[model samples]
Target: AKQIDDLTLAIIICLSRLFLHISADSKYYQSFFWIAMSLLQIHDTKLFASCVHFLDQIVHSMSDNGCFRGQGLATFCASARKGPSERMLAKLDQLSGLSFKYDFSFAVAGHLLKGLKNVGTKAAVTRLLNTFVEYSQENNPANVTGYFAAILPHCGDNLSESCRQRLLSCSETGSSVFNAGMVPDKIRASLLFTYLVTILKSSESEHEQLYIYKALEEGAHFMPDCLPVTFDVLMKKMEQILVASQNDQMLTAVLAIMNCVYTYGLESSSPVATLNKQYMESIGFASLGSADQFNQNQKGALIQAVCRVLDGFLQL
Candidate 1:
């Protein structure tokens, strides 16, 4: 064990020195980075701190040198998308420090997203996403939570139902882990909103949306700033229901989500709330134009759901 510790420490020191000395564009940078990432597989406080610093440096380098907009970014982004090894994920889970954790996870997530934009194949993207879910399933779900938080808001459109549920489970686990710590209120609020937005975007089933609504109710102390985003996303989902497959359960789920949002956030007369109210009413009326497509019972249910949401807003 002592020999292993000494070896790990030695590698950490060597990688620290290499990162300090190398330019972001240097040919050796990628090789050194992979070596450093592999070293994270070893358990050592000093090594983990060094790895976190290395992650931070990668972000700084990107900002300091716009030149990474080309090959340099692609290389690092690809590496990040592939993610760290399994043992490394275990090591990451055991370590703790909010800022460092955020930096480490966010850095990798940012890279993965940057690389995703350039990928030509949908299969490749799905493979990358599968890797993330597998990581959560095989290890501590919170180990790479920042990645999920970042991905949910941007990559949700392509998620399969099973994948979405697994991701939601991971987010729930991560939320508990974060809540146990001294995480900032704003960060917690934002994270909740992030999950909410993703669910609103991709959730096709009433069961899934109900899960999201319950989550919102549990974490309802979100900041007022969440109003606009919640309103916009809910409105978009509402519009999608009106124009596309007007699934009654989905429409009911949207109304439930709106109830939670309005009940906990925004003032009674907030212009944003009023505008959403009006928009929803207009959407309901517009849907009536296609009344020929629906039976009397379906139309009645639809109108009742809209009226319920509008009444909730009115009482507020």
Candidate 2:
């Protein structure tokens, strides 16, 4: 009997998550949803956590509040899509700071993406993502990660693509949408590049790293068009990495990112090529042999390899 109950709970959880994507109006969906919720109260297994997760999703999407929110948004956008609503925008306004507090930033991003076709949806997502960019410029470098996840996935003429276009246009103007409390535009740009290359450096394999960097550069092509960043913005970031290159892991990623920028960063010419000389001269990559053991030998071979980028070449 106990085995049967556990099996019942497992099946209910699976159905809830999978069928949650189905039309909410369907009779089977309504019936299954209640069954899942009821089972959630009875289940005491460790998997109850996952069951609660699905239940939270169900509540967010199917509750009367979501419907009310969706309806208000629909009415606001009804006059041929001018923009998002004051209330919906207010909800979005709370997203960046709140999601960080709850570690639900990505979950919120995913939910918005899922609802891109629903009422007030695009404006909600695009607005929130834009705020994240603004946030990254000032305090949360991780905001860049959220920003990328919002756009890098599959979707049609959706909010993600729309946000991408808006950002691209905004980047061209070298203007900021964020207010006074945010970080300087240059610092935001630097943090963005650091986050990008750091992820590439953390990849599990050489082949994976290559694939990741390619994908990263493709995302980066959108960078100059999305934010107030420029080649000079990226160059400033590269300089930061160079001065700190005694961390061998960072140096490898830095070298690869420089090549990506040089090869795929910009259309005409990237100023990143200039960072090579700056890095070669930094003590982080060099030695006063008599000065200190750690300083002289730390990442020594890597220093030789990376500094060669200043010579205008990619080496093995």
Q: Taking the tens digit of each residue's C-alpha lDDT, what string does model 2 give over 59-170?
A: 4455432432423211211221122222232232232111212222332343333233223343444554454443223123233343544433322124344455544444
Looking at model 1, the pairs that clash are: none
Candidate 2, TM-score vs. the true structure?
A: 0.26
TM-scores of the candidates in the order shown: 0.36, 0.26
Best by lDDT: 1
lDDT of each: 0.42, 0.36
In the range 109-135, model 1's lDDT, one tens digit per residue, is 332332233324223433444444433
Predict model 1's lDDT versus the native: 0.42
lDDT of 2 at 157: 29
In model 2, state the lDDT of residue 163. 50
Superposition-based RMSD of candidate 2 using all C-alpha atoms, in angstroms = 19.8
